[model samples]
Target chain A: MVTINKPATKLNEPSKPQKSSSPSLTAFVKAFKNSIVLIVFILLWELAPQLGFVEKTFLPPFSEVVQAWWELLVTGELWRHFEASILRSLFGFLLALALAIPLGLIIGWYPLARDLLTPILELFRNTAALALLPVFILILGIGEVSKISIVLFACTWPVLLNTISAVKNVDPLLIKSARSMNISSFKLFYKVILPASVPTIFTGIRMAGTGAILVLIAAEMIGAKAGLGYFITYSQYNFLIPEMYAGIITISLLGLLINYGLSSAERYFSRWKQ
Target chain B: MDKIKFERVTKKFLVRDEYKKGAQREFTAIKDIEFSVKEGEFITLVGPSGCGKSTLLDLLTGLTQPTKGRILIDGREITGPGLDRGIVFQQYALFPWKTARGNIEFGLEAKGIPKSERKEKAEYYLDLVGLKNFADRYPHELSGGMKQRVAIARSLAFNPDVLLMDEPFAALDAQTRETLQTELLRIWKKTGKTIIFITHGIDEAVYLGERVVVLSANPGTVKKIVDIPLKDRLEDADIKSNPAFINARREVWNLLHEPEFQGAHI
Candidate 1:
């Protein structure tokens, strides 16, 4: 159990023996510290090349990577690559969400359905997501469908499993109270069960978003000509160190943006969690 | 017409656990109980835990089925829970997600009141409960006392003819419990709605009730019904100062200590 001290608001002393929790405000402090750490690492990386900590051919300075990024942006190459990667991840995420939630709700709501499906989902989920890339390429060709399908497969399990768990584990008291009020079962599912399961569902979505990004990038690296992954691989083979570093930076930025978008949404849906 | 009338009400609960030596244990919560409530009267049901005071309330609310009984209100059989019978649960069962106003609007919504009318009705109940300012706030934002008030507001929204409460204030601190009891009595007096309260606290039953109905433990049946005479139910005066209050509390407490009820608090 963890305890945290905070600015006191009430004069009353603790009446009950309970474990304390960290305050919400500390999250901002943690985030600020992380940014400082990242900046320090970047400053070190920039100076290492100049100090001959590594060969210049093998390593690029931070300024050179920024210059390559600027050139790519002007020529629309960076935008094309970034947009393709973003679109694939988004499309894959939406498809997985569409497939998972209702199926998860059914799987979660009924014991028989869950029993029939758990083994199949477990089997598929156990196989490494990347191993399916060749099979997908063989069936759909090395194109958008193949790359998006790979991402969709990777993202589906977490969303589906989380949704199932969320729906199954709603607070029993909420159900009892609603039933006592003569609330119809359908309305109970919509009003009480659905809303109660939201926090866990959001957790699944966050996982899916990150998983989709990782899978899409890996898939794109195989054959794609216009994506962040493709740019990184293409630049690496040609030994264009700065552009390769720029591609790595682009991937980092993409991940940061996606994490921010999903986390904020999680916050919005789980306002009552505290 | 009686606000509530239960005739030959016997409830049998099945203990379906296989480990029991027999097929199943038939534990009776309430047995051969019969009672009726007068219109607009406040009646309290006092008993040990699991003595069926709450089970009786649940039966009255149509939350559970009775094995053998007939429950009637105003002339019609109570087929299921309806707006006329509002129930306040022990745990402050206000929906966690909804604002105070949202909970109050629930019954009115079930009745299909117009949006504008429902809003007005919800605000009226909120004001009556002295929580008009907190209407927009969710249940999680409020303290335990505040949440119970919202639950009360929700129950009172439709001006239910018969309000059934199962130890609503028992979960609160002693101070909050006393304060809420006063507030509840004030609401009942102002609305003139019939109330059937269930509790184990003899003091609480005597403090808020117009009549305290005591029940014997397990296979529960009514033991006695003591009338409480308050000069002014609205005014917060010294109940202990009144000899009638003292006599009624002592009578009920003595009735609870009967020999048949020995070792019955299980």
Candidate 2:
């Protein structure tokens, strides 16, 4: 009983009168227990180079990487790269979302639209975004347009496909029930279909979020004056290994933040799903 | 005058023949389904599994058009579903995203009722179905019986004169089914709304309806319409235990079991 209460205390406020102080203590212990593996991995990362398990130049200690990250942060160099990547991914992801959702809804709702577009969609969906980067660079040039377009291309498929399936898969009984009240087609779509498809559409959006980050990183690595991907490549060229690790760490943290944001949004939208 | 009428309604479906590749066959679900309901009357439809009981309700709701003949409501032809009628399906059909009150407000909103009036009417029906306390609860948060109650409140909220229910309590346990039956009768008396309920349960048909319309299968059509005359209905006696109730149940049972209909035990 106490063990069950301990895990739940992590979520709930400290309101129980039986052991107010113990709840916090239990929460801390639970959190510690959960992250013990992560703590050990971090410890090993810090110690391996110092203990001569690996060469210092190849893999610096975790502290040295953290120090490098702080130095880059203070110099404001990291922020410039971070800002460039953030803007590109954000614009690309938003564009894909704006275009894909409406198109997907139409295609899913109307069989004629689905039949007309599905063949073309499937042809492009199978073509990798990275493979099209060179063509995009040649057509759009090695500018912000090209980098953003690559992210847009990669992100579009997940959102579009997921949205299409989401709309198509809404329970037919819901539609029947709504229509029985003489609801208009527009009302049926907005009131019934849209809300019913939310959770599935969110699944697509999250996948697109991840794709936006990864594809933008790859595009930046290919050609960019400033961005986290470019910074890492530049650091590698100059043998600034710690700084390279720092850029990699920044990308990882950014991915975590985006994933965390999407999951929270999904939770809020689907709160009724038990 | 009859509140609702079904004039020689026949529904047909085209299906691919299982044995013959790419071949289509015509199947008749119900033939010449003719009936009439007086204003404020309560009627129950009972039939075996393939008797097109659900198909009949769908036609009445205007979810589907009859292949032949037509349905009428208030002496006007029903070209499509209108606010004059409401339907309750076997599944609660409450929107998971909407709370009990929100679901009740849906049809009213569609009917262009003002927000305040919609809220008032939703509250009234929520209270009518004994789900006032659960007005804020989502469909998934409610129990099976509670969800069905919310569904009833939602349909009733729009003030439709005719309510068509397709086995609305078929999914509940016997206790909840009986309880909802009593509640339904009480609401019918209070609101004076005409109801056409479809069910497989003979006891349920006898208990709920003023008249039970028993149907035969294999191209479904009406077989018998049994009138139930109870001296003490729900208010004064255990109606199910009454002799009239037993006799009505047995009569419907005998009609369904007359060797022509298949799966009559259902």
Candidate 3:
């Protein structure tokens, strides 16, 4: 009965864990290693055309795109197109906001109305704003109205849905608490529910702003005569690849700028929340 | 005249959907409950949690319509919630977007107090609740105790005829709860306002009430009403260690623990 198991291995042997002093540093090193592919991509783009690996006529180098950007800047044509696109986007976006906000508030506050209209709105929201391009072109004849309609369709959903959910998601406790204080009905909505939902509402506006700009450019590209989208299509057709690429760059920059502006607005309004 | 009265109030509830319309089961929430509060009285409704002390308060505040009876406040029938009765909820329900001063001035502004007078009233209560430095801070920025204090200040700013509170300090930590209770007493004294406080906490009921009314489990009904007359003796801190405090808590505890409270969730 005194049979004792001998040491299967070194009983007190300390198993060492792999040394990792800083996981964050390791992650940074790993990311840098992974970015080598991107570096190679840039290098290939820079060197391929110069080495005649591809036809220079069809595809200009990045340098040529930059040079085209400089020429456009000097002539102020770039700024003009940029201004036109921004103005259309702004007008359409504001118009849609004015329409959607009150409508959405009414639907959200009344359960019966929301239930009645939910299916119809679902159908319209699912129909792509771009798909209405042909209908808009026929009715508005490719003028400001057509372009504005496209932008308006793209921006409406985010603001509307956000408003509805913002109203719907107000805490029951807040309502009960307010009623106990004898707050008037109008006061309850403005003072309690609206303020409670401001953060979520801002999220919607930011999304709508970005979406309107993105869709506006796409619409403009298809039918516009003078905006940046129009200029890109014209340059591409006329064998001006560098200017075409320059237009692409400008579109991305405009999107980034709009996103930055809306984000700042959200932060400003919600500063007190945190 | 009584400040508030509920004459033979009976509340019923449907137990099931009964969509067939012909058949349904109804449960009694409270049956023939009758009580009243006097002017300048501090009445604490103490019972096991489901005893409908809060429902009674809601009736007095006109937030609910009694199914079979009537409620009178200052001999007038209660129709709906009005500015005359101010309530503090279990959760400190301050407006999150506004600063402490803004919340305090809210009622007065609605009642058309001038800008200077509003500022004066807000500042006065801010000082009373010891939140003068926190005047510009929003509710989200303040601690739980501070928010509750601001709520009290806002409620008192209107000089409500009756103060109705439903477990106002239940959400606070023990220290904060005790502090608020004492503050409430101080405010009650300074303003001479009638207070109807509801609680399941036996110790708090004894400490805060001029009279403690106890109720049995559902179908809730009043079982005992103990008139403390202990306010004079409770002036000192060490007075809590006196026999009366323990005796009151024990009496309420005894009334609450009768076989019904063992199964109730509250």
Candidate 4:
């Protein structure tokens, strides 16, 4: 056996076992340092109304919003609306994914499909999803279908266009290499093309997820009985400012949670990239 | 019988001339090329940059069609890429997503080898390349030499009759190149598979090949074929400084600098 001696460098050395508990303490302190700006912002928000910089009835202090959020949580009313919104967004997003991915692959792979569908796609992609809300309500009768269709419309373009571009732009060298191996065309697509296009596809899926939430909330606000969007709008009309703030905060938190979930999935799928 | 035969093979490409729009020009990459490689022979094709060395390999692999004439392996015409020949590209075209063993198992998987057998074969080849411990490491995690080694292991794992290498060591440092050259000779001797290595380096061609086929540039054609007769050169550490090795190197160098070969140099 030939023994090839590599250079001695700390970079390649395996990590040593930690003998002290001090490192975890230091890491906790470092995390706090990173979040210092957010902490200060929350503190300033809490003090602004108490200092009379704004009227409490109009803007309400951060603490009052939290209290309203807690009361809603205790009564379990928020959970119902949250579950409804989550289900609508997820169902629409998944449906869009199922339709868009296969169509995108087809359009990207064959020039005939691209030539026939490109102009139509461009036209629909340019039109805003919210602009179609009234048309969808007219066509689908303002029920769950209209709301779901709005989310689907908003989410589809990004996922479809990105998948098309990803499939079209796979490295020619990779295809050449695989072809030289005498692999079948079907095997080439599944083994080489799909894996290679995954990172870019994930980018599109994450964008579609964000788009689904935004369109769903806007759709929910229009003639809806139960949703975070309806709750915020209804509370504002009833002069329950703290409840309105709580609803807005909930929506923001929901967006953050969706983003975190998508990013984690992206990381798991693309672990080989690093 | 010769393992590979090229009978009056010619290749032409249609290229758009940059200076004149709407005019397509026919550029001859190689013309009337005739050569044959014996089974288990180590042959090197050496030339200047645009001498169609890579195009020749492409034709051999059946990746591209010859404009005229035909190439035969074991007296049968090569229609397209098949399992009989394997190739190692300069870029090391390993799938970045796969680990070392996974990349090596790619061809076997294509052949419908079962998972257990594929794993065993992949491990065997990885060990042959001296990367047994690196089986689980991805391409990005390996160094340049390690990556090339993995690529070599991958090609060899498929057990093809002929191995076509296109300047496979040109990107490495001098030290690593020398090490790999020796390792390749060892592998070639062990496996006894026909190897057709393409390179521009005169010394590298002489060091590894039994016979070096030198091609002239404009419309690439064989200029000369020089035989290096040192039988046990790979066993010598200082073969480069040996007298016969120097004389063969000088001979090939003189052929490349001939007046007819001068204008092709940029």
Best by DockQ: 4
**Clashes in model 3: which pairs?**
none
Superior candidate under DockQ, 1 versus 3:
1
Native-to-model Cα distance after best TM-score fit, residue B206 in candidate 4, in Å = 1.1
Give the distance in Å from residue B86's predicted Cα in candidate 1 to where it truly belongs: 1.2
Of 1 and 3, which scores higher on lDDT?
A: 1
Tell me how each candidate scores on DockQ against the true complex: 0.28, 0.64, 0.25, 0.75
- For candidate 1, list the clashing residue pairs, or say none: none
Any runs in candidate 1 off by more than 4 Å, and if so which? Answer: A1-34, A115-127, A272-274, B16-25, B231-233
What TM-score, computed on C-alpha atoms, does each candidate reach?
0.88, 0.95, 0.86, 0.94
Give the DockQ-based CAPRI class for model 2: medium
Q: Return the lDDT, model 2, position B63.
A: 78
Of candidate 4 chain A, the 10-residue stretch with the lowest lDDT total is A1-10
* Of candidates 4 and 2, the better by DockQ: 4
Give the alpha carbon lDDT tens digit for every residue of B39-99 in model 4: 9999999998788998999999898999999999999999999878988989899998999
Query: How well is each residue in B1-266 modelled by candidate 2, as lDDT tens digits?
Result: 99988899999999899989999999899999998999999999999888898788888888789999998898888888888888898998889999889999998997889998998999899899998788888888788899999889888888899898989998999889888988999899999999999998898898888999999987889988999997557675577778888888889989988878645545
RMSD per model, one decimal: 5.7, 3.2, 10.5, 4.7
What ranking of all candidate models by DockQ puts the best one first? 4, 2, 1, 3
User: How many clashes in each structure?
Assistant: 0, 0, 0, 0
